[model samples]
Target: MSRTASDQSLDGLADGSSVVVVSPERIDPDARVRDFDQLSASAQRLFVSEEETNPATAADLDPGDVVRFTDYYRVR
Candidate 1:
């Protein structure tokens, strides 16, 4: 069964709490996010290339991919 934000009925379940964990993709500072019809000044900003994660990120991605949120303002 799908989980929700609040479903405390898992008390009787043998497994861990029925609480669902939501992990949203965080926009990296270096990554460029489309705001509207155009790209912002973040053109210099590099972002995760859809293969990386905040934690437990596998090297399945590229190096130029945004590895950290602070990679943008870190400066060259």
Candidate 2:
């Protein structure tokens, strides 16, 4: 959507309240802005929003899969 310079004049904006994210570029009447992409809010499921647990946390490994090194030099 496009708003003309006059359409974007401060008269259209209500007093004491404004959008939290007004682009400073929009403050100039001569400047025109159009959003090609915008972020919208949607409630995401807990499966996606919740912290993905670390698979290794509190995990017990099979003895065969465990590897331990006695020397730090081995890491290089």
Candidate 3:
């Protein structure tokens, strides 16, 4: 699967570097979402990726250094 910019950046982060995970609210009301099962699967993938990346504490995140997940349906 093709990786998003955030995903690629996550891959390049140092094991102990500080980072932040932001799950933004879905803003497009008209966009179609998959079923509960599919959404759950997507969430699982996201969680696994995060665990693998294993970023350090978010106590001192920079202004723009964020891993934002915006579109739920397009996560995978």
Maximum-TM-score candidate: 3
Instruction: List the candidate numbers ranked by lDDT, top first.
Output: 3, 1, 2
lDDT of 3 by residue, 1-76 (tens): 1223333344454543333332345223443433323334444354335453322122322223333334322222
The CA-based lDDT of model 3 is what? 0.34
lDDT to native, each model: 0.26, 0.22, 0.34
Residue 69 miss distance in model 1 (angstroms) = 21
Tens digits of per-residue lDDT for model 1 on 1-76? 1222222332353443222222224334564322221323333122222322221122222322322232221111
Two-way lDDT contest, 1 vs 2, winner: 1
Best by lDDT: 3
Q: Give the C-alpha miss distance for residue 38 in model 3, angstroms.
A: 5.3
Q: How accurate is candidate 1 locally (lDDT)?
A: 0.26
User: Quick one: how many clashes does candidate 2 have?
Assistant: 0
In the predicted model 1, the residue pairs found to clash are: 30-45, 30-46, 31-46, 47-66
For TM-score, candidate 2 versus 3, the one ahead is 3
Worst 10 residues of 1 by lDDT: 67-76
